[model samples]
Target: MSTIRDIVILCNNRMAFPAIQTLHSLGRLHSIGVPVENEDVKAFCAVFASDTGINLIIIEKSKLKFQLQEITAIKDLKFIFTMTFPWKIPEELIRQHPNLFYNFHYGLLPEMRGADPVFQSIKKQKNETGISVHAIEKEIDKGKIILRKTLPLHTDFTHGMLCTHLSYLASYILPEVLTLLHRNDEGMHQDETVAEYYKKPTIADVSIQWEHQDSKSIQALVNACNPWNKGAYTHWNGLNVRIVEVSQTDTLSADQHAPGTILEINENKGLIIQCYNNTQLRINTVYTDEGFMSGHKLLAFGIKNGEQFATL
Candidate 1:
């Protein structure tokens, strides 16, 4: 009979769901929410600590510190973890079981690596986006590549939608990757030349830079961050309405409406604003920090036709 390993999991929701389903079937079960200081995660850990065969500790990378509270007790505990959480791990942890520590990123490494990589790629208007399963280093996501694969994305996909897909990809690829990793004699090395890095998207990144970017780029920018991350921000009659939804228009004529002018307004057509190259932009929706408003409501809010919306 094959050796059945004992496992304890530490992760937040999005990841915890899938990782839980996969591993819980294979070994012992323990689940936790992010605010790791919570009652359930702590109580579960307290019970889990009683077992010696339960050597494996699978946790999201950031929450590794949750393990430290009762440090000396679980000192010899083994782990196979990922780094998507908000906590930190000591060098001693990684050094203890060098190969056991694994990090998963949603990108094709030697290319897209780091936070919001998929969002960054889509915003940059790449033809495709991919996911990478790599080991994590102290320098963050800079580690050896394990498995990399690109997934198809529809042009209409919003950042929220894309994240959902990537979350699925991470969940699906993880168990298989773990299986392969366990059997591997040596891990694969990544090429530094093709390696790309990124940071979390900034407020400036969410806003549209009208002058510097072309229409397609601008549209992609709008598409990439829609429904989340503050949308494609600009100015709407100085009201600071965010673009929540968009679609490139075949009807955008050489006619320039005022920046925030109602160049075109129809329930189906949305509100079109004029731009360079006679291009018109149709903003389907707008969102405030408090709530989201549709283009139709913009008119109700006293946004008149032919009036320009200035960028703030």
Candidate 2:
């Protein structure tokens, strides 16, 4: 068998999502340009920045790392990042050393298979979440498996919280996967039949759809954007209001009032607006081009109880 090369650490945690926690635990790696410092701590882009001979890389983004299958001088002994690694690369970059080695994924390989694995996993409220270390082939997360382990997702875990959990897991799990590679040990191939795909959601995609959705759908929208994009929505009035905090009411009603219409306003309660299907959305926080506006003051500026949102 061939001997191991060097180890690379790729991270894009400027956002410091869950994957960052795990990358922190792995053995140290050399840093150059903006990768760990300048770039997201969870990016595998660091591998080819300077040197190659990288046999391993600890994906830092808590998503997936390394979007490419092959690395010229670097070989990721492992994969870890927020996105998947593509299969092929131009031959010009390849000399003898490879560019990437391996990748780590937040969800089951082939299943829950896409970027924002951690985010998608948590929002779906899966009973369990895990990480995967796989070799970079053409199709992402479709390469030969190197290592994988389970990590539970708690109910209270938000995007931030899930990121923390996965980061910690990367710490403990990476070294173990490396040991396997060192010993020439390869793990199981994924069951392609079970594989499912998810797209990387945009800030606009997760925004509140104040039309005929159910209360549960509203909650999902809120959860999807938490800790990152927050809420994607406009104000109960014409202004844009980023929904920060949300709690569902027990019952659903028919307010006839247009969804996104402000239903109630008070100093203490903030602005309660009619959301999907008569569901009420209590918005405690808002953002204007200027800054933040207190709930009470918003009401004072023509945000009365019965007045339609924009009219007020």
> Candidate 1: TM-score?
0.79
Off by over 4 Å in 1: 1-16, 28-78, 254-262, 266-268
Instruction: For candidate 1, write residues 94-191 as lDDT tens digits.
Output: 66556655666665676776676767778877777767776656666667777777887677777777777877777677566767666762457888
Summing lDDT over every window of 10 consecutive residues in candidate 1, give the lowest-scoring window.
Answer: 28-37
Q: Write the per-residue lDDT of candidate 2 for residues 249-281, one digit (tens) a residue.
A: 543344477766666678766666776656776
Q: Residue-pair clashes per candidate, as listed?
A: 10, 55
Winning candidate number (lDDT): 1
Per-prediction TM-score, please? 0.79, 0.67
